[model samples]
Target: MARTDTAFRVIAVPPARAFAALVDPAALTAWLPPEGMSGRFDHFDARPGGAYRMVLTYADASAAPGKATPGSDVVEARFVDIVPGVRVEQAVDFVSEDPAFAGTMLMVWEVTGVEGGTRVDIRAHDVPAGISAEDHAEGLASSLANLAAYLER
Candidate 1:
């Protein structure tokens, strides 16, 4: 069995702003990063069973396709739970013919009401055997940093 890890960060923007930064496709693009990467929401019904998909492109030519990390060039997911303006949970999986995923990636993006803004907690489970918990952790942190930057701007 693979181990699952939780990554969390408390955003400083107000709830509305934080939430806006979350659901707004443009806002998400502004911060979602790692060089050569961008994403768009396919259909954010924002409720359970609502489907969502995103495209991730390799920014670097030197990187092999198999080396494309999670959220690197492609991601498709569905909302597992949504609490309007409060929280959004997702079941995410990698969409790849890369022979790596073999199946969909399962993940959750949880937003909670905090003192000033919202707390973001990302739980990624059933991670592929080759995936790196440390790299994912760094990526999560970077994304949160980008989110903060976008929200504050």
Candidate 2:
């Protein structure tokens, strides 16, 4: 499957601070979820091959879809690689019975130092057919925007 790519620039925040917002569990909880969602991590281990589980709840129950419950979406993930203040790669699978949403997808986040801030580029490989590219792209953009906002503050 073709991958989905998204990139964003975070002004006034260096690579280290931007990368911290990516790896830190507390910071992740604050900004990982896109607009209208809240996230909780059951456990997070920030190392290669480490496992984690995250539950994302929709602020509006009506916004949830068939692939997940009325108010939440669950994901089981493992860190494939971690380069401090630089990049993070992970393999993620949705905990849903829906066939279209099944399967593991690789997500890579590249952080680079740019003039005045950091540039974050994200790619999702083998994205499930159940998820539309448009929505995925939007969600990614929103997450990146969230990260920028969190870091700049």
Candidate 3:
């Protein structure tokens, strides 16, 4: 069976602003990486049918080895659906030699206006078995926290 991981955060920004950050490579690189990791984009095109490649590097490889490389996790993602100021859906694949990590994961990011700000929801489906549930949950929470901090500043 496929696994799904979800997370949400109320950011102190409007839906449009949050949506902008989702498609902006610079903004994504600033907030998408979890704690103890940094990210860089090899290429980014934010539009339907467009794709992006991102490399996330762990600060301490000894603590957690990467899926793609010893210290980095490389991801190639295609934009499956893009609704400005509303939602962004993607098909993501990890660049890994391990067969356990070989599969496309569906990711949906939705932003809706809330009372104080915008609510950002992230749903990741078909997460690879190579990624532990606990680690995935922690990573999702960390990224959401980072997004909140980035937008609230």
Quote the lDDT for 49 in model 2: 91
TM-score versus the correct structure, for each prediction? 0.78, 0.94, 0.98
Structure candidate 3, residue pairs in collision: none
- Kindly report which residue stretches of model 1 are placed more than 4 angstroms away from their true locations once superposed: 41-45, 63-72
Please provide, for model 2 over 59-127, each residue's C-alpha lDDT reduced to its tens digit, 9 standing for 90 to 100.
887865635676788988999999988889999999887888988999989888988788888888889
What's the lDDT for residue 18 in model 1?
75
> In candidate 1, which residue pairs get closer than 3 Å at backbone N, Cα or C atoms, i.e. clash?
56-73, 92-105, 93-105, 94-105
What C-alpha lDDT values do all the predictions have? 0.68, 0.85, 0.96
Task: Please identify which of the two predictions, 1 or 2, would achieve the higher lDDT against the true structure.
Answer: 2
lDDT of 3 by residue, 1-153 (tens): 999999999998989999999999999999999999999999999999999999999999999999989999999999999998899999999999999998999999999999999999999999999989999999999999999999999
The model with the greater TM-score, 2 or 3, is 3
lDDT of 2 at 121: 85
TM-score of model 2 (CA atoms)? 0.94
lDDT of 1 at 64: 35
**Off by more than 4 A, model 2:** none
**Where is model 3 more than 4 Å wrong at Cα?**
none
In model 2, the worst 10-residue window by lDDT is: 2-11
lDDT of 3: 0.96
